[model samples]
Target chain A: MNAQFRRRIASAALIIGFFVAWELLCLAFNVKDIVLPRPSQIIVTLIERIPAIWPHAVQTLYTTLVGFALGIAFGVLIGVVIGSSRLAYDVAYPLLVGFSSIPKVAVVPIFVLWFGAGTVPAVLTAMILCIFPIVVNVATGLATTEPELEDVMRALKASKLDILLNVGLPRTMPYFFASLKVAVTQAFVGTVIAETVASNRGIGNLMMIASSSFDVPLVFAGLLILAALGVALYVIFSFIEMRVTGWARRKDEFALG
Target chain B: MLAPPSAPPHAETYVALERVTHTYGRDDRQVKALDETNLKIDKGDFIALVGPSGCGKSTILKLVTGLLTASSGYVFVAGREVGAEPVRVGIAFQNPTLLPWLTLRDNVMLPLKIVPPFRQEYHAKRRTEFRDRVDALLDQVGLGGFGSKYPWQLSGGMMQRASLCRALVHEPQLLMLDEPFGALDQFTREELWAIMQELWIAHRPTVLLVTHDLKEAAYLANRICVMQARPGRIIDDTIVLFPRPRTIAISFDPRFVALTQRLRELIVVASPPKDSNP
Candidate 1:
């Protein structure tokens, strides 16, 4: 078998082995399902309750995606502004740092007070969380463009806008993609935080309700679904990143065996 | 020393720097990079500015290309004053500054997409025509089939060749080369010099090449300007009398050797002393 296939097999074996060990450990101890549910019990609960849980899962996915999309759009806009001009960067950077430093969880209540316990708070939080890294990275990418390349453009009598469009934006793709990966994960966190405290629907709310009834396996199932969703989104972004900015990656970075 | 002939601002003077001076920074931090530097390059002349580091060879180029305005005096190109508008010049630097993301063909076509006249027609279904020009230039530089490849995939020598094509693809009137072969190894550098000579001969652009290598200056340029550092100014201008289609064999010629040696002596005398080892 090829090394990549072998590596994939090894990973699958490791995950399956861990679950088998968890099952046996719980059985030997005769542990109560309340204290900690076995992997098998959690999986069974997930399967049994999936019909009732489907809508909540969809709700969580929708909120996270909406928030993430808004976050990316807002982040890229701020990034371009801060990145292109010295004055904007200087004026906006300190305020952005202070705002990003404020715990996103703390702002959910204020969002609830303004927009009232719903999807808006989640999106705003996700968007705010995403803006910092994207702005910092995009600005850095534009600022670091080679002066020699800029001179090349200037020699051709290209305008400032033309220079930015031709050289500045394309060069920022690698940095922008890097920030996207970080921001996507943060988007999920923001959505879940808002859902648990304020929303009547979604996986976070389902988990909170399950925990109150001491349906521990159901809570674990909710956690499992969120993890899967996060992984799915992350993987999709990674694929797109490769397609867009593969030129920036060194071929030897992933050595073939 | 024979007095250099004064340029009378003739119609054929494609580029002229009349007592131009350039200073970097401002006030106490100010440092003079060029001082009353006067140069005249004819419409089709190929000239090399040879000097030690910090001798303002590059500064002169920046001024001519209108990337930097002179601190004093007139800088003229194509009989018009430079500055207040960008000059249409093609530039290639030592690093082969190709956009990593673009295919070699796309990079070569970049000037047409941005420069006036060509850019006006760039989006109007003339893309195929521009692509043909890019391909033709690529073929000339021996990168015929490699146009679709990204610059990162190419070897250093190949990338530099592509850089040359990008600089010349627009058929610019002035070509500014700032140590375009400085980063290459000896064999690669010589090979590029021959290619450079052919390109210049094909379509003569009033060329200003800044180089540290005296032999490279002697091989490529019809006239060589030797400059002195610390408020830099040209110390000597020697005209090379070599015939066209000069080959590598001609570098061994006694006259060629004497010319390089003379330029070397002028630089060595003017350059500052190195830090002594105790």
Candidate 2:
């Protein structure tokens, strides 16, 4: 097999082996479900209760996606402003850094206080949590445009806007997509944080309710569902990133061991 | 088919630098890159500037292209002073600088889509026409079939050839090259020199080439100017009387060797003392 296919098979085997070990270890030690539910038990619960849990899954996904989209829009706008001007970079970047360093969960309650503890609070939390990385990556991408290329554009008599659109944006795609992968995971964290604290819906709320009632398997099932959704979104974004910025990436090459 | 002549012969000088001075950095760190440098080129002339590394060969190009304003005096192109707004010029550098994301065709066609007169109607009606122009230039540079490839897919020589096509695709009145072939291997450089000669004969832009290679200056340029470092200014100007479509074999000719030798001697004289430490 080719190295890529072989590598993929190895990865799959590792994941399946981990779960198998988890199942065997739990059964051998007679582990209590309250402390750590078996993977098999979680899977069974996930399949059996999927119908009841479907709505919460949908709610969490929708909120995270909306917040992530808004985060990207605002992040790119701010990034462009800061990246294109040295004064703005010097002035605004420090404030942005300070804002980002504040633990997002701490701000979730503030969002709750203003927006009344529902989808709005969850979305705002998700957006604020994810904006920092995207802003930083986009600004870096814009800032790193090659001086030689800039000379080419300048000699063409291109305006600043033209250079940004034709050169800067294309050059920024790989960085932007990289930020998206990281930002998407952060968005999920933001949504779940707000959801568990205040919302009556979503996987986070369902998990909280299940735990309080001692439905340990159900809580594990919720965690599994969140992980699956996260992986799916990551995969989707990775695929799109590959399509949009293929030129920037090197083709895979075989290496000798 | 080649496009019609972009410039009709005119009595007025097409490019003129009148006592232009350019200083880099500010205050204590300031260094004069070019000092009261004066040059003039008639329409469709090929000129070469040869000097040591710090002699401001590139500074002169930046001024003519309007990328930088002269610290003092006037820089003129196409009968207008160059400042604030850049004058139309096609430029290439030591690096190919092709956008990795763009296909060779798209990279070459970039100028048409950006420069004003063509950009105003680039997509409306002239895309295919512009594509044809790009293809023709690529063909001239021996990169015709490779137009669909990305810059990274090509060899360094091919990329530099594409860069040349991009510079000329817009048919700017002036063509500025700053050590464009400096990075190529000897064989590749010689091959490109022949190709460059063909392109100039076909397009006839008022070409200004900057190089350290005295042979390159003698082979391609009809007029060669040698500059001195430290408050850089031209010290000698010589007109080459070689016939059109000069071949690579001409480098062996006694006259060509003498010309290059003369330019070499001038550069060595102008070079700063070897022992002087900054």
TM-scores for all candidates: the values are 0.93, 0.95
Model 2 clash tally? 0
- The TM-score of candidate 2 is 0.95
Clashes per candidate, residues 3 or more apart or on different chains = 0, 0
Considering summed lDDT, which 10 consecutive residues are worst modelled in model 2 chain A? A248-257
lDDT of 1 by residue, B122-210 (tens): 88734688888889888887889997888888899999999999899888889999999999999989998999999998888889999
Give the worst 10-residue stretch by lDDT in candidate 1 chain A: A248-257
Across B18-69, the per-residue lDDT of candidate 2 in tens digits comes to 9999999999999999999889987788899999889999999988987788
- Provide the overall lDDT of each model, using Cα atoms, as 2-decimal numbers: 0.87, 0.88
Q: What lDDT tens digits, residue by residue, belong to model 2 across residues A1-257?
A: 69999999999999999999999999999999998999989999999999989999999999999999999999999998887766777788889889889998999889888989799999999999889999999988988888788889988888999999999889999999999999999999999999999999999999999999999999999999899999999999998888778888743220000
Model 1 RMSD vs true structure: 3.4
Q: Is the docking of candidate 2 incorrect, acceptable, medium or high quality?
A: medium
Candidate 2 lDDT score relative to the true structure: 0.88
